[model samples]
Target: MTLVPPVTAAFTLEQSCFGKLRHSIRAFAGSFRPPQALSLRTAAHPSTSSVIVGFEASTWLRSPINALHSIPGRHVTIAFRTEVSDDGELSAWDVQSRKGQYDKVLNALWEMDLRELRVLRIDGLRWWGDQKQLFQERAYPFPPTQDDEAPLFARAWNVEVLILTARSDVSLLEALTELPAARNKLLFPRLHTIAMEWPRHESVSRSIVVDLFQKRHAAGLPVRTFQVLRKGGQDERWEDLLGFTQVVVHDSASE
Candidate 1:
């Protein structure tokens, strides 16, 4: 289910009847949790257009795909966060380490046409090599294409906005904030707005942030707007970003 499902949906979390009968038989790192309740909630609410899951998210990956499938006309916001350790390690929720255990789940992500998505958001989740390899493998029989190496959202050409919430040591900065290797290798080609919710003051360097914008401008693919989200009222920080694009501040308290 997506987009603020009904209150009744919470009841299924406790004792879903589906859990009693439909438990996954496959061996998991620890134990498997039945995901049937996810499908049931979606079935109950037909108007759902957004889906966000946190705990036991891997078990629920199939629910959205089962509904949307290969259709690209309808757009939805899908956010799922699995458990990742503070030291770049994965918890039992990690699906990629299981080999072919979740091939269908990975396929569900690849099969969906990502071009229709308008906003792509990334937090502190460490994708390791999984995200990169996803596109790399798709380039089979074509020598390595740009899609094979570009960051995940870079391939979704239609995306207009990118939101990032990252820490200093997160791999996302290493993967996304860096300048493109080639002059023609522009990232987030159609993105006009970039929002950074600085989780900590020391999270990312201002020079690194400004350099990315400057590089993009030189390549003729400049982002038009940059937003910084702060906890309380608006505060003056990284104002130098104004040199490259219109700077906007968001007061998270009021929101």
Candidate 2:
């Protein structure tokens, strides 16, 4: 799995994007771009067994995402970065534009089969538009159609690892904890591990983390581990993350 680099940028398959996905020791990292185009409409990839199981794009788009989803059963991870992407950097202009673009990508993701998706990593809370709206999908409810799978934007039921390397903000955390239609609905039913690195946020506190775990535990959800990343920033509940999950402070240095 380590060898399979995350498809990033214009969903580019390049070495630099690998650096973005492959967490390095000692320091930190940035975003990525696309290389040569690799169309999937004609046929499956040359070797689709496990070439890429993840996506790491800053501003996610629908076309490339659709192309990626065309290949069946290999979708394992999907990431959203804060920086400008190769797809359409103009969306960074304002909140309304970002909201529209982000909304479209979420709709595209909704249509895909994401059962095998294990890891969901999101970077930069800045990209999140209209803090209250879940991808501006208030009117658009869960599962689009009765037969459609539950949208990840609404609830990533099978996601095991939830990674939040975003900036110091609670918006992303709050959004991840619930959905637009089901605000009270707990997210990621199978989520067992949470790795976060948004430290010293005025809004983020020990109670927030505790509340997250408590709510999930009360619902019979398994929040077995909490990985506090100290690479960029730190959370206040360093030593306090004990009851529901093992309080493991993860450092930036490589293992």
Q: Could you give candidate 2's per-residue lDDT for residues 164-254 as a string of tens digits?
A: 5433244455544554443455666777877665354655465687777766766688588876655454444544445667766655453
Expressed as tens digits, the lDDT of each residue in 1-255 for candidate 1 is: 223434323311222221221111111111232111111011111111112222222222222222211211222223222223366565565434332222223323332334444554443232344434332234232224454534334445565665554321223433343443332445557767766654446535566667767766766778888767665454656656656788766556445
Which regions of candidate 2 are displaced past 4 Å? 1-102, 125-143, 147-151, 175-185, 231-240
- Itemize residue pairs with steric clashes in candidate 2: 10-34
Give the whole-model CA lDDT for all candidates, comma-separated: 0.40, 0.41
lDDT of 1: 0.40
Looking at model 1, the pairs that clash are: 2-50, 3-50
Error of 2 at 149 (Å): 13
Candidate 1: where is the Cα deviation over 4 Å?
Answer: 1-107, 134-154, 166-184, 199-202, 232-236
